[model samples]
Target: MAAEPNETAQVNEIQKEYTRIDKDWLSLHYKISIGMVLFALAVECIMGLILVNTDMLNTTVPKFVFKFILVPSGVNGLCAVIDHMVVKSEKISQTAKIYTVSIINTVICFSLFTAHSAFTVTYYVFVTAIILTTVYASYLVTLSTSVSGLALLVISELFITWDVDKPTIFQSTLRLGNFLIALFIMFSVSMICMVVIHYEKRKNRASIRIEEERITLTKRLKMDELTGIYNRKALHDAMRDLEDCNPQDNYIFGITDIDKFKNINDSWGHQTGDKCLIAFAQLLKSNCIKANVYRYGGDEFCIIFHHTDINEAYETAVLIQDQLKKVEFKEYPELQMTASFGLAQYGSGMNAARLFMSADQALYQAKITRDAIRIHEKEI
Candidate 1:
């Protein structure tokens, strides 16, 4: 019983954190990645329209645009478009999407690396490595897993082709060693970032747990111990809030008392008396489903019908009375039990206290004729 609600609350809290992390990551990734695409397009425009025309880099303008600008931009643009769709789809977890994006980025870096000598890609690999570690995950588990996979792919490309570019074994060895050093640097940087991210996630979970405990404490303060319904303090607070509404706003106010409550406690015991109260409280809540019922104290309870009229409130009270007659106590089958109700409505200019006094007076009248319902004489 206790376990179920606690587990559900924990799951709910986790889902909220999951949603926030997903939304934040998607927003950040889309902005930064799209910006990267724009930068690539800018390079395409400048190098093709101006720089290539000046015969710089000894490459044809069209060829340079196709190789350096258009190809990379097209791939990056496609990635941005696909990433947006995937992250927003709801079916895919952001963790999986992060991995997908990391792999794509690694491929992009690999493209730049393979297309040029190792010396030319220092700025590109350094920036990519730093950006790769920024997406947060659990205890560094997810971060490290995804980053290591991408790192391996990039490192694997270093030895992929031993073509004319590396004519000698020593030159190829040096290139591999250089790229290996960069990979090591990237891995070290990622390890530090993951530690920071792990700490932040722990802090977030701790904050949520604190908030949950605070709410539970607040609820306990307002809840009845035996009956599990709103207590006297809660009832008072509710009445205050109700009275804060406009004077003209109508509401039903009522009180209920167990028919011969003291006799049950005296005859059976306080424990049985408590069981009766709990059972009676459950019945009241079910019958008055539209209203809030409070276990005002022993043998006394209150109900509030927000925005309901006198007639409906009275009808509901009658139902509760009828239902009580059919309710059975397993311990004392021969003993039949019933409850009396007194109902009133908030008339114009009536404050919370006055309205409840009217109900209490009617309740007094009902008590005179046990197991009966009475409307306030003023309303009659």
Candidate 2:
């Protein structure tokens, strides 16, 4: 058999909640990525300044060369700030920013090669740093599958540069071996980081799916199959929480029961009686503006209005009765049903059990006195 209308509504609500949580997680992740990139740029700038002041290079060459190398690091920082301000899911904009930074770094490396006649050990180190930083940052910003290809190109360039025979301290076999070992280590670390990131993304997606399923199951358990409202158990749990919180403002609890419901069931079939209950539940839900509606057992409904005054609660109850009079039960065109409501407001002496009993007593009075609604008034 197909699920009832109430069950479908509950499922929809749970799905909405899960979607909201997932979006929040993604926003937080993007913010953290932006922060990390900014920090990395700051460290790179400090290292660049230190290199210009040290005895590593002759003053005759000028310090602007070091400054030129740091330009791409500055660009990375600017891109990170721009990415942080944009809305989430702008993947095309993010990809463009990352590619622009990568191209700038490549240009800087080529410029450095042209500036020097021969590739010294320090120059090779600087070029390798630029290539590794470009590849890693591109991978972070894009999560593209072609990052490994770019890394291989970098490694190939390093090997080709080392093959040139020149009178330099970097031409020894021991230095060549060290350079190869360092390249291998960097490649291995980058591959490992990529694997970990991919695994985490998969794990997070699975966890989100599982959480959605659990929320669906919990909704089914707490909701009434017939009335599309909280079951009696759920109602009690909510009342307990309200009682524990017990704010300074007043709260109202109202109980409503269908009048002469058994007579309608006896005259018509039980299916028609079920239809009447469903129609009445929808009426209650429509009338509940700031209150929570609950299915408080068969033929009985409850409403809890938090942070509401007694006068407002009474006015709301009268409005609900007025609306119910206009409902024409389509399934049973000739049939009509009326409801009796009893309301009580919370005060210093009120507890959940006592408040419920007070509403029940007022409801009994409404049924006996032929009144549509009754409010319990304690004598001053």
Candidate 3:
């Protein structure tokens, strides 16, 4: 089924907000990638210094320094630069950003492994890299990066013999078996991360749906069931808004009533009276663009004009009264109707109650005249 118009609008707003948040997250991820690379560079330089001080290298000083220190640092810097370029590209998709970042992290980890190939602990750096990819919460990125890093590890193990002695076939098989076990554990970690991400996304969607329903319900409660305009409850809310109005701002209140509306209900029936009320509401809605129209009760309707002078509000009411006279009901063509209006303007220190009572008094005068307009001049 198609969504309601309001629901469609809400969805569009949500999509726009999500796009903004996604961009911010991507930028943060890029900065984190840069920090990680810098951290890797620092670790490499420190380890190289420690190894040099211990005189642990089997090779010459220059060879050890060049292979362990310079090469690893260069790889870190190069990966950081590549990540910078990818994040700066406006046309790149968010998925592409995640893919690039995950690959760069793996490469940095691999370079560190290359420098310390003899150390069994350094081999586990690949596992750490795979686990870090889970930070993006992307299943595809984690899976693909894990598989690629495992493949590189297998290839490196084949040619790069860590020990001085040539391993027998059984020893080689045992090493390969250990690699297989590590691969299984890495895949399991990736699966768990994906499941947690899925659960979080589902929970967020449910919360959003509940919030939308609440907003829709609030709107329904504020609206008149028959005329679909603001109801009496909404008018009370509007009155509360008066306290926040600026002192320089002009506010006009108008109370309008259909003259002898009871006669229409008595002569024609309540259904025709309802139709007349709906038509009057439409007239108010179409004519008073800058005002809020409310169904006060029965045939009495209220209008609160924002930032409008009393004269302007009075003129609008007159125009509505004239137009209401011309409205022809299809069910009862011979019937004619006219409405009375009472207007009052808010003054300094005047509260919403005072303004409404002033308008109501004027409405009483207009009702006595029947099919006329009146204004209450008292501001206090």
lDDT of each: 0.70, 0.61, 0.77
The CA lDDT at 280 in model 3 is: 92
Select the stronger candidate by TM-score from 1 and 2.
Answer: 1
Question: Can you write out model 1's per-residue Cα lDDT over 114-164, one digit (the tens) per residue?
Answer: 433424353245446345445554544345444654564465464554223
Q: What is the clash count of model 3?
A: 0
Off by over 4 Å in 1: 1-18, 40-62, 83-108, 120-170, 189-194, 244-250, 306-309, 330-334, 377-380
Q: What are the clashing pairs of model 3? A: none
TM-score of each model, in listed order: 0.76, 0.61, 0.77
Number of clashing residue pairs in every model?
Answer: 0, 0, 0
Residue ranges of candidate 3 with Cα displaced over 4 Å: 1-32, 53-56, 81-103, 113-171, 378-380
Per-residue lDDT of model 2, residues 153-191, tens digit only: 344445344224333335567555644664565556556
Model 2: number of backbone collisions? 0
Q: Write the per-residue lDDT of candidate 3 for residues 124-224, one digit (tens) a residue.
A: 77776666655455668778888778776766666564334435224777655666776677677667767876775776588678778877788889889
